[model samples]
Every structure is written in C-alpha cells, then in structure tokens.
Target: MKYSSKNAQETEKLGKKLVSKLRGGETIALTGDLGSGKTVFAKGVAKALGIRKKITSPTFVLWRLYQIPKPGRIKYLCHIDLYRLTQSQDILALGINEYWQRKDTVCLIEWAEKIKRFLPRKNLFLVKFEISDLNTRKIIIDGVSDVRS
Candidate 1:
C-alpha cells in the first residue's frame, strides 16, 4: 500500500504500525535515497518491538543488533546497512544468510538494492521512499502482510 507522510514523524508512525504486524523470520528491504528517512522509519519499528535503547543509522558499523524483551521472550532484530559495501561477497561474508534462515529473528536491510539478488522472493517486505517535498515523503509499502493500525 502507499502512504504519504508530511514529515519524518508521520513516516515513523507508519513504520511502527507496520512493525506491529511483523513476526520473527521476516525480512524488510528498504530502498531510498540519502536522507530519505529510512533510519527514522526503522527507529519506529524498533520502538514497536519493545526496544528501549537508542537507535541510529548503522552506516559506519554496517550492522547492528538489538534485543527486545517481551513477555516470556526475547526477540532479535538485526539491522543491516549496505551503503559502504562495494561487493556482494562482503555481505555474504557477514553470514547474513544464517540470519535469514533463523525463525527467531527479524532482519531489516537498508540499501537492499545492493543485495537484491540474495534476498528470498517470498516473505519479504519492500518499502520505498521518495522525497516529495522539503518536509514530505511519499512512502510505498508492498508485501503480503497484514498491518494493523
């Protein structure tokens, strides 16, 4: 579905709503330009997942893992940033496929266009963002998942 947000806050709210529907073993592919608010949207997802720690763009680190505490459970959220990688082999070396195989983790990949070939056809959520104005963004979300507001 398509969602329009007047500002980053609105975009994040949309992200949070989408996150509430997510289960473990899900993958979300995010594609957008620089400063398109992909990281802001991700912070919303983290919050929805009961993560209280600070969230930041993993540009320099490439990947960051967050643990969320739920009732009688712990959920793993792996956030990956592929902005600086120059080769697909770099991604492969990170053992991303291992995380993909796990049924107890959710992976959110930024700059997913860089590694599209490695992603599974099914069980993937694609979120694309475009800057419509100085403070507005047109976000398009596509997948077969149900997201409740």
Candidate 2:
C-alpha cells in the first residue's frame, strides 16, 4: 500500500501502524534517500513496540539490538544500517545474516538496497520512501500480505 506523510510526525505514525502486525522473524527492508524519513519511520515502529530508548540510525554502529520487553509479539528488534558497507563480504563478516535466522527477532534494515542480494525473498516487508516535497514523504509498502513464517 501507498501512504503519504506530510511531516516527520506523520511518517512516524505510519511506522507505528506496522508494529502491531509484526510477528517474530520478520524482516523489513527500507529504501530511501538521505532525507527520506527512514529513521523517523523506524522510530515510530520502535515506539509501538514499547521501546523507550532513543532510536537512532545505526549507520556508524552498523547494527543495534533492542529488547521489546515482555508481553509483545516479538522479543527483540535488530535494526541494521548497511549504507556504510559496499561489499557483501563486509555485511556477512559482521554477521548481519544471523539476524534473519533468529525466530524471536524482528529486523528493520535501512539502506537495504546495499545488501539487496543478501535479503530474504520471503516473509519480508519492502518499504520504499520517496521525497515527494520539501516536507512530504511518499511511502510504499509491499509484500505485507504475503509475509509468511
């Protein structure tokens, strides 16, 4: 489905909408340009997941793991950023692939195009973001209904 966010707040609201639908072992591939509100959307999802820590893009750290606490659909959130790595080997070296193998974790990846070849073809949500205007973002979500365990 397609969604339009007039500002960062709206973008986060869209992200929040996806949280309840996530089950463990789900991977989310997010693609967008520099200022496309990808992080904002992620923050929204984190908020809905009952995470209290500040959400930041894991560009420098490469990846960040958050516990979803108790009474949630998923136990963990593996947020990854592949923008810094150009080689697939580097991605593999960081053990990034291991996140998808966990049955109790939900992963959200930014700059997912960088590791497109490494992403799973099934049970994934591909989110594409476009800067439609100075303050508006066009978000497209695919494969949501097709997500399987």
Global fold similarity of model 1 (TM-score) = 0.91
Error of 1 at 7 (Å): 0.7
Question: All models: lDDT?
Answer: 0.82, 0.84
lDDT of 1 at 7: 90
Report the poorest 10 consecutive residues by lDDT, candidate 2.
Answer: 140-149
Query: Please, what are the lDDT tens digits per residue for candidate 1 over residues 20-82?
Result: 667677888999998888999899888888889888878877988887778223278899989
What would the C-alpha RMSD of candidate 2 be, to one decimal place? Answer: 3.0
Tens digits of per-residue lDDT for model 2, 1-149: 88878999988988888876787788989999999988998999889888899999888889999988674558888889888977866877876666664778889999999888888887788999999999999899897652111
lDDT comparing candidate 1 with the true structure: 0.82
Angstrom error of the Cα, residue 121, model 2: value is: 1.3
